[model samples]
Target: MYGVSTYALHSLPLPAALEQIAELTDYVEVMDDGCHYIESAEPLLSYDLRYSIHAPSRSVNIASTLEPIREASVRVIEDCFSIAAEVDADVVVHPGYFAWAADRERAKRQFARSLAHLSAAAEERSVRYAVENMAWEFFFLQTPDELPLPDGAGFALDVGHAHIMGCLPAFLQVPIDHIHIHDNDGTADTHSAIGSGTIDFAAVMATVGQNGITPVIEVEGIDAVRSSISAIRPYL
Candidate 1:
């Protein structure tokens, strides 16, 4: 099945974005953030849609060495997961970054501790949590080899980020349960429409098709979302 993330309509209010998404596709990954939030899930329950959530991460740093910051991050994400249960949604989360002034190794350990907590929390709620790869210069999970999640957790592979980092093939090597599909120039995470950038969606889709993995298009506009859907339709 194919879905579109509300990320494409991030500028719109949650209700309006959900309305548009309902018209475009039956599946939507509601990005729980500023313009889109889990609090708006009540309206979503009325729609015949399969839902997922891109957990809020703007100020959330699960890898922070400070105990308070890390705990706050977990609470924010857990709140998102709590809402996920009400709407029968899975969640995708950013793995986290090491504090710029902190010890990288120790921060990584802290990050792992956070993932373990989230993994148990997700299982308890009967929702799967998939950690996403980041495109930042010093974040964990930039590649598949960097272990981010414990057993019973999954990976949310962002194809655009992988292409920008020249790690699409490497990221594909990991076990993935969810995907964020979009395009970007090799230089940046522009979230362009499919075929508007250099990444090889054909090969990507071929692999996704064979594996029976569904992807949620994560572009930034309705036209881009529609274009991406058309571009990937042949494989489906």
Candidate 2:
């Protein structure tokens, strides 16, 4: 089955977005930021659908060189884990970025430490998390060559991000625990409808089938989400 992300209706209130998305798919990945920031599991209990959370990434940087910021980032995600546990939802997390090219090594060390802490936190909560490969050069884990993930962390592949990084083909060969599907011109992260961009959804769907995973349709608007669902249905 395919899933949809609240990113498509991020302008709406969380409850309202979830209500509308429920009409489209039984699986939903809540983009836990902006209007949908999940403070608790209370808002999610009303839904009969399956869930996965795209953890709050804005202002969160597990790779910060500053000790306090790194600690705070881990805590933010730990808070997200607590809610995910209640909903039995796996979370998607961005691998943090470095501020400067010179700080890359230090940032890598910090990210490793954060992952170790998050692993323990997630284990305690009985929830899983997948560290997503990023779209930009400053972010860590932009390619499969960066594996194996530390602390037994799972991989959440964003096909659009991979395409922008020009590594989608390599990513498809790796084992993916979760996936976010969207199309974009090779240059920008537009999150367009499936058929409107350059990504070959046929190959993407073939990999999804082989991996036995549900691909979350993470487009920009409700209309695009609907189009993407229709575009992808043939492969399902």
Candidate 3:
């Protein structure tokens, strides 16, 4: 699954966007970070492109302390599902982010409830629900053992984020059905291409092998993203 985040394809016409990366990859993630295909596929989305949707993020966390923001998160995910259905893509969702880590306990409860809502909506749309683990967040799908992840609930691991949080061990343990591959400086989320940072790329691959998991790289822009894939190709 050599998929690049379409956030990398920002602002280009849909056909031009698809043509730009067509030769380098096969799958794509329709990130709400930049592009909007609300009215039509333009041209690229018109193709039989395999897709995955990264839900709207940033301050749109489902675990917000405020009720309105939390509800908004659900509607946002619902919109993502509608788009996924249009593109025939699976959906990748972040349960939501908390502004402060202290709210983690309450956020956990909120996430559980939110997931239930998302799960039902997703099931109806036939969209896959992949919850992502973050680099700096209140809590992760903290443990694989904790959740009642029905038949379809899966995980999207962010490897560089794992290294940042110093959760390498736990990161290796989760059932990785999907991933957000990127690199970051220890101090911040740099989103640099793989091998540009201090992470042990080979060790990360070995861990993936050990766990029988395959994770796609989460990157920005096509040129840099293509390079990152090459850098990690040997291990992959």
Candidate 4:
């Protein structure tokens, strides 16, 4: 099935945001962030929507070299997983990034450890944990060969991020369990509509469908969400 993220209406209140997209789609990937919280789930539970969650990644890095900070990041993500279990939602998470001075190999090792912790937690709660590829220069899991993908964990393919890294085809070569579909200008994560940028949606959609991966259109704004749906309908 296809869906849209609550991120598409990021500025609105969570319940109102769900209201806006409810008619347009049956699946809704809630973005568990400061702008939208798990507290909104009570109101949403009454709806007929199936859910997934994008765990908060804007401020916390689970792979930080600092022990205390890394632990805190894990705590935050565990909280997100708890929320996901409550909503019966699968989670999409960014494989944490590292600073320029941090030991890249060490950071990668630490990230693997973090994923192990999160994966266990997800398994206990019966929630699917997915690690998303990142677009930034220092992000981890940029290539399929580098992805450990840990036991019980899954891959969340972000087409926009893959485009930014020039690794869309490389990513498609891997097993994708979930997807975040959006367009970008090849230089940034602009979250543009499907046809608004350089990525090839037809091929992307074909691959996603072939793989049986449900895609979350990660666009921002209601208009963009509607436009993207229309642009992608044929692929579905």
lDDT of 2: 0.94
Candidates 3 and 4: which is better by lDDT?
A: 4
Give the TM-scores of the predictions, in the order they appear.
Answer: 0.95, 0.98, 0.83, 0.95
Q: Top model by lDDT, which number?
A: 2
Q: Write one digit per residue (lDDT tens) for candidate 4, span 1-236.
A: 68999998888888889998898999999888866867545765878899998888888898888778788898888988887788789899888888965578788777888888998888888898888988787888777787657656798999998999898988887788899999988898899988999998888998898899788999978899989988998887
- Tens digits of per-residue lDDT for model 1 on 12-126? 8888998998898899889888878666468678788999899998889998888899989998998888899889898999888875755798888888889888988888889
Ten residues in sequence with the least summed lDDT for candidate 4 = 35-44
Is 2 or 3 the stronger prediction by lDDT? Answer: 2
Ranking by TM-score: 2, 1, 4, 3
lDDT (tens digit, per residue) of candidate 2 on 1-236? 89999999999999999999999988999999988998999999988989999999998999999999999999999999999999999999988999999999999999999999999999999999999998887999998899879998999999999999999999999999999999999999999999999998999999999999999999999999999999999999
lDDT of 2 at 222: 95
Which candidate leads the pack in TM-score? 2
Colliding residue pairs in candidate 3: 181-218
Native-referenced Cα lDDT, model 3? 0.70
lDDT of 3 by residue, 1-236 (tens): 35777666667755666666667677766666544454343443666667776777754777776778888888888877877777777777775656677877787677777788888888888787688766564655544454445446677777777677777566666567776677777667777788888777787777677766545666666777888888878976
List the pairs of residues colliding in candidate 2.
Answer: none
